[model samples]
Target: MKISFLCILIAAIQPFLWAGAAKFGGQRSGTRYDNRAPRDTLAHLSGWPQRANWAQQNSFEAFPIFAAAVLMAYAAGVPAALIDFWAVCFIVARFAYFACYVANLATLRSLVWFAGVIACVRLMCAAI
Candidate 1:
């Protein structure tokens, strides 16, 4: 499979990773995960768990655009190396953004978000 295609899978899965962390990462702190009422559980989370939930939400928001960009680039006959490079950079930036969000590094998270956006924009431009 093309690396860009693989990145779509990774990007899809990334939000679940954050969701898992948000649900389970705070279990030891006396907040049991409410599987039946997951949204309620997430709503009460604070600190890292809360931030993890935010990260998960943002990941979901970002995925469609990234995936569309990759598909568009492939459809437009953009070079594999270029597509793969931006896709990988997007993945790396998202991971960094997640870490920064959980750690409360607001400024750094914004910078990383810009990097991810740039990757998606590059892919879109290449497709054009």
Candidate 2:
């Protein structure tokens, strides 16, 4: 498989890392996992834990666009190396985004999010 495809797999699992952070926080706080009202519980989380939940949501929101971009680029015969580079950029930006979110660096997080979006856009443009 191409490295870009591997990055897609990494992106697919990124949200789970953030979700695990949230769950870890809940465990630390002695809160039982409530399947029925999970969102309600997560909604009340504060600090890094709350940010982790938000990050997870953002990761989910970004996945489809990034995945589609990769697929489109491949289908349109974009060079594999170029696609791989941008895919790596997206992955790095996402990692930075997650770190910034957990650290409460709102401005930096937003910037990283923008970088990730740009990476996705570039990948799509390369295909066209």
Candidate 3:
């Protein structure tokens, strides 16, 4: 349940990267972005090329594991909690990965990525 809540929080806020976003108060001086797309303050820009990169990278980060988890749960007759845990991991890991990527923290990003993948694998194995 905690992970579920966190997952929703991640998903809800992520698109603010592309959508119009701004810091509420600044002398055009203190915020990373006072009047720019939130993506600009990010380590990478979000032009078409960047958006495509985001799409590809994010899909790789989350979808396959989700599909595997669902199918595995159905086929192996696993309980809902196991699948939910995997889904939660997928969501949280994506959040962590995005944060690390934006901050340009190369090493920690990979660790977070691997953790997510491992959580997915664990869920599948438990299902089976």
Tell me the lDDT of model 2 at 128.
Answer: 88
Q: Which candidate leads the pack in TM-score?
A: 1
Query: How large an RMSD does model 3 have?
Result: 6.7
Runs of candidate 2 exceeding 4 Å displacement: none
**How badly does each model clash, as a count of residue pairs?**
0, 0, 0
TM-score of 1: 0.97
Query: Candidate 2 — worst ten consecutive residues by lDDT sum?
Result: 26-35
Whichever of 1 and 2 has more TM-score, that candidate is 1
| 17-112 per-residue lDDT for model 3 (tens digits) | 423222222213244442455445433444333433353356444665556655676578666676667767777776677666656577997898
> Across residues 9-127, which tens digit of lDDT does each residue of candidate 1 receive?
99999999999999887685567898899999898898898999999999999999999999999999999999999999999999999999999999999999999999999999999
In model 3, the clashing pairs are: none
Candidate 3 off by > 4 Å: 1-58
The RMSD (Cα, Å) of candidate 2 is: 1.3
Clashing pairs in 2: none
Candidate 3 has an lDDT of: 0.56
Give the per-residue Cα lDDT of candidate 1 at 60: 99
> Which ten residues in a row are the worst by lDDT in model 1?
23-32
